[model samples]
Target: MVAVDDMNRRILNLLKADGKLTYREIAAKLRRSPSTVRDRIRRMEDYNVILGYAAIVDREITGMKADAIVLADVEDGVSVRDLRKLNGVDGVAEVSAVSGDRRVIIRLRAHDSETLDTIISNKLIPAGLKDVEVRIIMEEIMRFPGTS
Candidate 1:
């Protein structure tokens, strides 16, 4: 395992809060040399501790008006790799094999309620998901790494 020291944790926190922060900017905040900060970040990236950065987009602005969390039971003999196929399906955001009564969980988004229902009834059901429970996301209280 990669041993992340206190300094590295601080650097990670800064980067998580603002991925666009330059090494010099992070160094200034952490009171460390820019090169030192740069090296630590590079090491973390190489170890896959620090994955790629991306923009936190507003779903509404992108015409996505509906969001839902779908919990379902995976069919017999179906693998998590099989569930991964949903990743390419429209309105499917994230698919996870979680520890719960509903082992397979999916994060979905769509243009409206009708579309959301269609995705669940058509795509998800046809894909071998059973006993599906979809909970509409009324509000997102907090988004990790950064607030939405």
Candidate 2:
């Protein structure tokens, strides 16, 4: 991880609040010159510290209510190694090996229950997944890395 100074932290925090916030606004908040702020932001971008930015939209406002994160316990003796090979599994959010309950906690988003089932029964299972457990999210609690 790159070491960031107080100014860098301040800049990042400000950006986190509103990535669209202007450099002048950021400078005003950090009590630095706008040019300095701009340069710092550029340097951060070059260093890949500032990865990217996105807009946050409320799902309810967008009529996307069927969203959920499905966690499956692969049955059919499908090894964790093979489950990772599934086509629909984009970016393994987390993988944990446990004794009792969930062997692999895969995070996935779907538009509706049908899509969710298709993703699980069609794609994942056919890819060698057997035993599976699913947890449909009724609400989206949080999303992090702030899209960056």
Question: What is the alpha-carbon lDDT for the whole of candidate 1?
Answer: 0.88
Q: What is the C-alpha lDDT profile of model 1 across 1-148, one tens digit per residue?
A: 5669999999988887999999999999999999999999999999999878878889989999899999999788877568877878999988889888888889999999999999999899888898899899999887887433
- Candidate 1 versus the native: TM-score? 0.88
Local lDDT at 45 for model 1:
90
Model 2 regions lying over 4 Å from their true place: 72-104, 126-131, 141-148
Name the weakest run of 10 consecutive residues (lDDT summed) in model 1.
Answer: 139-148
Compute each candidate's TM-score over C-alphas.
0.88, 0.68
The list of candidate 1 runs beyond 4 A from truth reads none
Model 2 clash count equals 7
